[model samples]
Target: MSITERLSRGFVIFDGGLGTMLHSRGLSAGVLPETWNITHPEIVTEVHREYVRSGAEVVSANTFGANRLKYGAKAGEFCLENIIRAGICCAKAAVGDTGALVALDVGPLGKVVGWPGGVGFEEAVGYFSETIRIGAEAGADFVLVETMNDIYELKAAVLAAKEACDLPVVATVVFDASGRMMSGSNPAAVVALLEGLGVAALGMNCSLGPEQMKNILPEMQKYASVPVVVQPNAGMPHLEDRKTVYDVSPAEYATHMREMARAGARGLGGCCGTTPEYIRKLVGALEGITPRPITEKKLTMISSATHALVIGEQPLLVGERINPTGKKWIKEALLAGEYSEIAEEGALQADAGADILDVNAGLPGIDEAEALKTIITELQMITKLPLQIDTSDPAAMEAALRVCCGVPLINSVSGKTESLSAILPLAKKYGGVLVGLTLDDDGIPTDVAGRLRVAEKIISEAQKHGIDPKNIVIDPLAMSVCADPDAALTTLKTVATLSASGKRTLLGISNVSFGLPMRDSLNASFFTMALFAGLSVAIVNPNSAELQKAYRAYLALSGLDENFSEYIDFAARRAAGGEAAS
Candidate 1:
């Protein structure tokens, strides 16, 4: 069956663990199971046939670790291409005419990508490319990337699948018992990142039992608009007679699987400690049970590797002190190639209640792309706040997007044809939360209606490029009130209009106060007006005490700050002569 059909049908069931069954057949530990596809094709075929007979609609091939990184032809006895080709052959032979689909199973390269001197992104892509290409040619139905512990390496594998073939790509990351990846990606962040990248399905698998998986599925369901695949382990593994065995029996495992299906696990399967009996029991238990409906969440979110920042949940603050604009210290740091100074700015904003950091490396006469890469890498090292990569240069923007550790905000795509053409593809490829400035080639509008027209155009172009409206944040283009007396009013009107239609609105609030005396005073007041007018995100200096007080008060009044804690903390800091922003 095609992947499109598999995803469309609610409650599609997949096969259980092959490694568990293989080990029971005396497959030695420390011996790669992928080699069995060639050396003992009969045993592998029978194992797949048992799962297919037990009602598995989709079976992943025995090629999870068959990539060159683990089984290079020069380093191992088996050739990588030969092993992958044989793996597909074994699964296809098992299915025969049973109408079961074969998925090319892919896994991580066993190394993290975003460490200081770890494997690079492109290098990880190269490792997955050859194996995936061979699998596609050998007639695998789709690519199933599972057991991913790091979000960066997971992204690399998906990019390879998209580039290698037209097969559908489904990804599943392993969350610990705490419901976070080893790299600190939580369920919401994983769902936000994968759904934005257009995965056929995405969810949790491995490193956790069914009970542990149940703890994190609610958060995944809240943000995911696509199918959620759940492949929990049978239970925690333990040593039984020096062999690994799971605690939960097949019957008990089915009970948890049934609950997961009702909780929105449309694609159900088994991981590490499960077997064909587990799949058989799960299928039988879920019989006649209607699957949970998948709904469009319409959440506007961006993330770092650690935290997912949801817009409209609270007053979203994009820290604006990292740019070289009007900041002499930043300009000096950029010119002197002192990246530590740039990183320090992001750290300070993060400590001062900034939800995201706005990174700009657009200094004149420098290689903006290289400067942006350096700035992005350093900022990611210093803080977990998602970055807003602010650059007009397309090359610099792409460079920054490539290096960002998680979901970043791209600043920005405009209504101009030139801007959309260059940026939409990058956003689509890298899956960043895109900021769309509502200004066309005709320039900033003089009135609210004109700017609204530009906003509509930006959304239209973004959808045409396959970007969801949820991923597009509309910036109403805050103009200086000194240039036009009604500029702030016009921007406010546009924000109110867009927010009413459920569009996320962002504003560079400092621009509204430009050319005015006592800028911070005007900025704080104007920011309050914009917040009341439904502004979702604001680019501002987070260290300003006036702005902090305004935001804290707003949160308390709006019921976002639980029990007035944030406002109380801010007041206590000021009363004690402590820096409110610090």
Candidate 2:
């Protein structure tokens, strides 16, 4: 059976760390393991055979650091290509007729991708694509992108693997004991983005041993829709007699491996300090265990480079005052290239209880692309809140999405064919949560059902391009309640219907009160109604006391603000004429 088919059957076993074994065989520190594939092919084959004897169902090639970025220039001609070819050949020779699979091992580039003045997105893609191409040409059965920390680099590697060949791709990242990647992506955020990219499996590897992995397994199991892979180190490294040592023993490691399988890990392996004995015992320990059945998790979230803002836990308030619509000061600042002014606005909103700041630089005459990039880059440095990339220009959207430094929420794509075609690719490419406008080429739908149909059409189009519904937030076009008395009713009905169907819904709450008296009261009242209708997020002015009061009241009533602490605190501060509670 293929690797994907076997994953559904039961636990799939991968080999232990090659570096640990190589060190025992007199391999020096800091030397590339791929070099041994060429100089001592017999040693490489021997290591693979040991894993096969220990019952490793999948043997990873010793090519983790064999890319051109590392092996070229200083190395001789055909160094990278020859090393990868030999690595695959060594695994095949060792596992001949043993029913074991060979995985082309890929690792990170040792540098951050998409940082300011760092490796560009396509440059990083090219780096992994070249390595994947060599492995595919050398006839590997699977591609394992391991030890990834940055989500952007992970995206480039996965995209490269898919484009380079039609092999099953398994991705795992390094997480600290606190259960976050080095890039600040928590387990839920990583699962959402990686699953949206269509990886065959997702999990955590390295940094910690089996015991620490057990702590992170629940989070991965909670969000991962695909098979979960866990490849922890034998234990954290410590010094013993001037040498490195791992704390966990073979039997202890085996026991924890059993626990990991019980916690829903279908794919198990070892990282640093593990050897054939550990794998042998792990295989024996999991003999009668069954892997957890895959469950589809429909969590809606967006993130900055470090934090994920989960929607639907409570009503999320997206601060919508940063747009250059009627804000003369913001527009003038953008024209003058004064990003500190924009950053100040974002900082103020973050203090005022905004979960996300909506950033738009669509001035009439200026370069929207440059302005959006400038503002997004600076705003991220100022506030920890995730920014919503609000733009009508596809160029600006793509530019901002590429360099925005986190998983942003794209302000919109519409039901119009041109809009969907233009924006969905960027969303899919960059992995952003999309706000889909429920209107078509025929114009705004006056009735709730018509708007619902438009939403369905947009979702269908998005799926055709392989975008997940979890990454989509439907906006049912909040028309002005003053112009059409039934407009708010239609929008609220759409919100209630969509939310019940497991779709995330957002509403531009201020639009419902256009041209009305005491607009803040109208907006606040309608905002409360939308929350009752299960609205996941609202785009409104966070600076408005009326809207914030309504939000805090909903949270207290809905049991979101624990013990009504936020509500009571805000009430006391307001009565004392102190600064408002954010």
Q: Pick the candidate with the highest TM-score.
A: 1
TM-score of 1: 0.96
Over 4 Å off in model 1, which ranges? Answer: 73-77, 578-582
After TM-score superposition, what is the CA distance of residue 319 in candidate 1 from its true location, in Å? Answer: 0.4
- Show pairs that collide, candidate 2: none
Give per-model TM-scores: 0.96, 0.92
Q: Put down candidate 1 lDDT per residue, 1-582, tens digits, no spaces.
A: 576566667788899999999988879989999999988999999999999999998989999998877776444448888899999999999999988889999988877786766788778888888889999999999999999998878878888888788899999999988888988889888887787667899988888889889889998998888889999999999998987889989999999989988888888889999999999999998988888778988888898877798888777999999999888888888899998888998999999889999999888868889888888878877788988999999988887877777788899989899998999999988888888898899998888888889888988888888888888899998889998888898899999999899889999989987887998898998999999899999999998888888888888888888999888888887878755444
- Model 1 pairs whose backbones collide: none
lDDT of 2 by residue, 1-582 (tens): 777888888899999999989888979888787889888889989999999999999999999988878876755644788888989999899989999999999999887786776786678888888889989899899899999988768877887887788888999999998988887778877776676567888888888999999999998788777899999999999999989999999999999999999988999989999999999999999988777788877777687766677777777889998888889998899889898898899999998889999999988889999898888868866787888999989999988876665678898999998999999998887778999998999999998889999999989999999887888999997889889999999999999999999889999999988898899999999999999999999999998989989998999999898989999987887777776444
In model 2, the Cα lDDT at residue 72 comes to 69
Location of the lowest summed lDDT over 10 successive residues in candidate 1 = 68-77
Lowest lDDT block of 10, candidate 2: 71-80
